[model samples]
Target: MALITALGPITIDMYLPTFPDIAQDLQVSSHEIELTVSSYLLGLSVAQLFIGPITDRYGRKKPLLFGLGLYLLATISCALAPSFDMLLVSRTLQAFGAAACIVIPRAVIRDHYSTQEAAHALSLLMLIMGLAPVLAPMAGSFLGPIIGWRGLFAVMLVVAVLLIILCIIKLEESLKPENAVKLSAKTISSNYFGLLRHRNFMAFALSGGLGMAGLFSFIASSPTIFITQFGIAPENFGFFFGLNAGGLILGSQISVRMLRKHPSFSVLKIALLLGLGCCAIGLLLTLTGLMNLSLFVICMFFFSACLGVINPNATALALKEQGGRLGVASALMGCMLFLFGTLTSSLVSSWQTGTTLPLFTSLFVCIGISFICGRFVGRA
Candidate 1:
């Protein structure tokens, strides 16, 4: 789970500093270059729909290896892409590969652990995984200006090869033969729909999804808000970004300790309330013209910390009810969360006001929805 989740931040953070260069080279608007980011997300989100079921039916190893192989190829394609359209297509394909890495690991964890144990493991996993965004962007900010954006893809290609080798050597089949669901559409639909009909799963999934949307919305707008509006240097963005990532790490670490004492729902509720308060303050600051880059970063840190509490708990709760359908359930939940993220991110990208308004506004709405969902759906 750590490696899988880390891949996304690695891919994203490593290439962000290259955005200006890629834009200038392609003779396009910076927003146009951002489309590549969104395109990758779209591919990742859509591919999870199929990859989940395939992994459930076939066992985790084959699909995971195949996806890594494809990801390697796609990374090379991204490095060699000459035109903007080619890069966009390559990014989308790359996402298909990355999606497998992300979705399968969660299924594996679910397969191996009970609900509380899964949450504890996921919290640990997140503690490690969260470091990627912190370090990756900093690495990119330094390397991007020197090596160019294409070189970042080369790094990803190398990482994919390493992952592939690791998978072949160390990864065992987590899904037992008897537990595997049939791959037919009929079986797939039945499993997926059954999971959907469960109110607890829906509640958990929605709560996590909304929290994720808040983060995604912030990510979509951060570059412009920090760079254009606040006049922060590109080299410095990573440091500030890493601060928020640190908060996430801190929160996840706390979850490990909290799970031993408190109910997961109680933790989730407190986290959501904290998130709502942080976002509200952020919005108030932005709307009232009191927004400073320092203040914004502080608010983001708190907001993301709350998310750290919500995410793993919600996922563990959602996966608790699935006996043989862990993969499909994971896929369904991943798909919905990513779909919401994609929509929220697109909205942030389009509005591009060079201010913190979009960031705070989106966070407020997402948290509000999450809080409401938690109250109604989070009951035992």
Candidate 2:
């Protein structure tokens, strides 16, 4: 599950350090290269809309296999693209196919686990998934010089093929046939709409989604901010990037320990509240030109730590709170979550390219919203 979830972030993070190289080779601006991020996110958010119905109707294994097949094809197209336009098109299709890897794993987890066990399982998954950021950029930076940026896509394709084989060999269909929902558009719509209307679902989803949005903003903006603004070398930027991701792993493990003694809700509240304060200070520092790499990394670590704690717990809370149709519920929560990703990523992509102001501002605002949503959720 962690490996499957890692694909989404690895695809985004691995190629970040190769931006300047890609721009030079493809004869494009940094802004144009970043649009590839937006394009992929758009496809991902849209794909989240329907995977629920399909996955629920069929069991987990078939749709997963089907998606991986398309992912392989799209990734191969990405590697071989001769033009920037072709690369963008291929990335969108690649993300559309990769959506299954991101969304279905949660459904699979929710299918068998509940409460503290579910939270613990998800934390373990996140602990592993968090390592992708720690390693992907370094791998890409190391390999980009040797094989060029296009080779990174080829590498991802190889991983996808290998993951598919592993799935075939080891993963069983988790959603039992008798438990699967009967196929129909109305049932799908009803389940989705019902979940959306539940205040608990909306609350946890928004809180978690906002945290994810903050993370996406950081990822989208980091290449420019770290390399172009801070004068970090392409290859060494992974060290700083890995530092923040390492915080996530630490925070997740800490949350796992905290959960053993505390309720998930309290852990979430403390994490988000701390995140808001940290992000606000980060923004203040950026706006005043007091922000250095050390300060930036520190602030980002706390915020991402909060996110690492929030996501799995919030997801477990939302899934456990909703009683029926785990597939649709999971899908809706994922759709909303990536809805935040799509929006924040686009926001970062559209910002003036060289400034860290957007990164700081986006993080501050998103964290603020997360805390506010949590308060309202408690009241609701």
Candidate 3:
């Protein structure tokens, strides 16, 4: 489960360090390379809309295998992409394939655990998933010079193959026969729209989604910001990125410990408020021109830590309210994440003004709205 969950994060982060190289090799601007990221996220969101229902009807193992097969092909396409446009398309398809990796595990978790247990399980998963962010960029940076950006995609191709093999050998269907629902257009529509009206679910989903968007805002902008603004070398960028990711890992472990005593909902509320405080400090530092690399890293570390608390607890609370049809519920939650991720990442890319103000502003607004949304959870 941890390996499957980490697939999406690794795919997203590993290539991040090669943004400049990709842009240069493809004769595109850095902004254009960023579009590939946005495209991948958009594809992730859209694909989950359909994949969720399919998983519910077809069972987890079949759909998961199918998605992994598609992901493997898409990775090869990405490796051989000759133009920026081709890379954009390939990345989108790769996301389509990778969407299963994001959705199925949450559904499986929902199948086995209650709210708190699920959160604890997810926190453990996050400990493993967290390593992707810490390691992927560093690996990318080191390998990029040796093999070029295309070689990085080639590496992803190998990883995808390994994941496919691992799934075939070890992964079992978690979706029970009794829980299976028949698929129909109307059924799919009803399932999805019903979730839309579910206030508690929507609250936690959007709260978690917006928090994820804030995180992606950092991910999308950091390469350009660090390399261009801070004059950090491409090879060295991963160290700083890893440092902030360490904060995220630390926070997840902290939440794991907190869950031993406190309720997930209570932890979520406190974490959201604390995240807002971190955003405020980050914004203050950015606006006052005191946002050097060291201070920026410090502020982001705290904010990332807050996310560690927010994501698992929010996910658990939202999933807890769904009595059945967890696949669709989990899919929608994952969709919300990538949808908001697509929006914030694109906005951060376009809003670049030679300062960190836009990034901080986006982060603050996301966390603030997330807090507002958090208030509505369990109220219904």
Candidate 4:
């Protein structure tokens, strides 16, 4: 699960330091290179619709293996991509493949664990997973100058192969044959619709999705905001990025400790309030022109830290009601996140003004959505 969660962040973070190089080499605008990132997110979002149902029906191990295999192939394609179009295509494919690695793991955990245990397990997984965002950018910043952007993909290819081998050797099929549903059109549609109608599921999904949107917005706009607007050096980007990730790590650690004592809802409400406060402050600073890079980074760290609390609690709450259809439930949650993330990211990319407006607006909207959904949408 840790490996699966880490893969998406690794794919994104490893290439971030290379964005400038990729733009220069491909002779495209930086915005175009950013489009590749959003395109990957779009592919991940769309693919989850299919991958979730397929995994739910067939079982976790097979689809996971197949997805990792495709991921290996896609990473190689990215490494050898000759043009920006090819890179974009390869990135989309890579994200599609990566989606399985992400969605299936949560379903698998839900399959095997109770709600609190699942939250505990996810917290541990996130602790491991957080290392990718913390370290991959730094590694890429150093390695990209040495091996170029292509080499980063080569490294990802190697990681994919290792993950495949690990899955083949150690992973057991967790979904019982009796629990697997037939993948008929009617059954798929009915199952999805059922989940959609579950108020708690939708509420929790929206809570996590909107919380995540803030992070995605930061990532989509950060390069331009930090390097271009604030004139931070490329190497320093990872340093600051890692600080935000560290905040997430710290928050997750706090969550792990809190889960032993408090109910999930209690933690979630508190975290959401903190997240809303942090984002509101960030936006206020931006509006007042008091938002320097340091202040922005500090605000981001607090907001992301709150997400650590928001995500696990919301996921646990959502899946608690999903008795037998954990896979579809997990997929729906993943889909909402990636879909909203892709949309918001594209909007941010399109509105690239070299100012803080796009970032603040997106953050504000995400927190507002999370607050509204959490307050009104869930069951008592």
Candidate 5:
């Protein structure tokens, strides 16, 4: 499950360091290169809507293998992409395939565990997933000079192949025949609408999604802000990036301990509150032109840490009562989550002002809304 979950982050983080090189090689602007991230996220959001009902109707393993196969092909396409447009297309396809890896695992966890247990399980998953953010950029930075961006895609292709083999051999069918939902347009639409109408589910979904918006805003803008504005060397960029990612990992592990004593929603509330504060400080610093590398990085680290708490707990709360509809529920949650990814990434990419203000402003707005939505989860 960890390896499968790692696919999304690895696909994302591993390519970040190569953005400048890719822009140069493909004869595009940096912002144009950033559009690839937005396109990928858009694909991820849309793909889950279709894949969810299929997974619930069929079983986990088959849809997973099919998606992995598609992912393998998409990775190869990405490696061989001849133009920036082609790279965008390939990345969207890659995200389409990776959506299965993300959506199904949550369903599998919900299939076996209660809400609190699922929250605990998700924190463990984040602990594993968090390594990608730490390691992938480091690897990409090291490899970008040696073999270039294409070589990095070749490496992802290899990982995709291995994941395929692992899934075929090790993964079992998580959804039993008895629990399978009937597949149809009507049922799928109805299920999605029902989830849309669900008050508690929407609260947690928006909370988690808005939190992710802040995270993606940071990710989308950080490369340019650090390497271009701050003049950090690409090779050393991973150290600072990894430090923040490590904070996220540490936060997840800490949440596991907290979950042992406190309820998931309570933990989520506190984390959201803290995250909003961090964003407010960051935004204020930016507005006053007092934002330095040290202060900005510190703010991001704490905000990322808060996300580690917010995401899993929000997911647990949202899907706890989903019952046999876990697949679709997970899908909707993922769709909302990555839709926020799409929005923030595109906004940051298009609105680059050669300043950190836009980044921090977006971050502040996202986390502030997330905190508000999170507060209403229990009330709903």
Candidate 6:
């Protein structure tokens, strides 16, 4: 479950170090290749939008296996892509296939566990998933120089194949027959609309999605900040990136502990305020021209840590009212995440100046707006 969940981050961050390499090799601007990230997120959102309701009707196992099979093919396509256009399309297909992995695990966890137990299980899984992005770029940085950037997709291909085999052998169906939803376009559309109409769900989903926007903004912007702006060596880029990922792990652990003593809603309030604080401070430093590498990394680490706290709580709260249709609810949450991620990632790239101000300002605005919106959740 952890490995599959981590695939999304691995697919994303592992390629960070190779942006310039891929651009040069493909005879395009680095910025052009960055569109692949946006396209992948867009594809991911599109896939989850449907996959959730499909899995709710069918079982977890079948849909997951089929998706993994497609994932393997898409990854291979990425490795063999002959042009930038081919790579972009392949990456989108890759995310579409991968979306099944990301969405199903949440529903699966929600299946057997209720309320608090589900939240804890999610936190534990998140702990493992946190390490994937942490190590991915570090690994990519070394791997890219050896076999070149295309080799990274070959690695993900191997992973997808292994996961397919593992799922076939070890995974079991979790959704109960009684809870099985009807398989129809009309039914799926209705369930999704119902979820959207729920006040608490909207509050948590939007806030969580915006929180993710902050993370994606940082992820998309970091390579440029560290390598291009600060002139850090490409090989060491992952170490700096890992700092923020590590913050996420630490914050997740903290949230897990806090959940023992407080409700998710209580923890969420603190996390939102603290995360916005980190972004605000970073913005101030950036505008003052004092955001050296160390300060920038520090602020981002806290920013990610705050997300670590916010994500699991928000997910738990959003699905707490899922009388059924856990798949639909989970799908909406994950879809919103990448949809927001796609928007934020595009903004970070498009807003690029020679300095860090745009990235900091963007992060501040995302978290600040999310915090305000979160406060309105569950109100009369």
Candidate 3 positional error at 106, Å: 0.6
lDDT of 6 by residue, 97-210 (tens): 999998899888888777677777778887877899878877887788897889998888888888988999999999888889998889988998888888888888888889
lDDT of 4 at 358: 87
Clashes of each: 0, 0, 0, 0, 0, 0
Top model number, lDDT: 3
* Per-model TM against the reference: 0.94, 0.91, 0.93, 0.93, 0.92, 0.93
lDDT score for candidate 6 against the true structure:
0.85
For all candidates in order, the CA lDDT equals 0.86, 0.82, 0.87, 0.85, 0.87, 0.85
Judging by TM-score against the true structure, name the best candidate.
Answer: 1
Give the lDDT ranking, best first: 3, 5, 1, 6, 4, 2
Candidate 1 local lDDT, 32-141, one digit each (tens) = 99889888888988899899999988999999999888888889999999889999999999999998988899999998998888889888888877789878877787
- Candidate 5 lDDT over 1-380, as tens digits, reads 87898999889878887888999999999989978877887899999998899999998889988988899899999999999989999999999999999999998888888888888999988888878878887888788899999999899989989988898888889898998999988899999999999888888888988997787888777878899988899767777777777777878998899999998888999998999899889888888888888997899889889888888888898998787788899999999888887788769878978878888888888888888888965542
Cα-based RMSD of the predictions, in order? 1.8, 2.4, 2.1, 2.0, 2.2, 2.1
The residue pairs that clash in candidate 2, if any, are none
Candidate 4 per-residue lDDT, tens place, 338-377, comes to 8888778779978976678888889889988887777667
- Model 5, residue 313: what's the lDDT? 89
Query: Which segments of candidate 2 are over 4 A away from where they belong?
Result: 20-30, 286-290, 348-357, 378-380
Off by over 4 Å in 5: 19-33, 82-85, 228-231, 352-355, 377-380
- For model 6, what is the error of residue 311's alpha carbon versus the real structure, in angstroms, after optimal superposition? 0.4
Better candidate by lDDT, 3 or 5: 3
Residue 177 displacement in candidate 3 (angstroms): 1.0
Error of 5 at 192 (Å): 0.4
Decoy 1 TM-score against native? 0.94
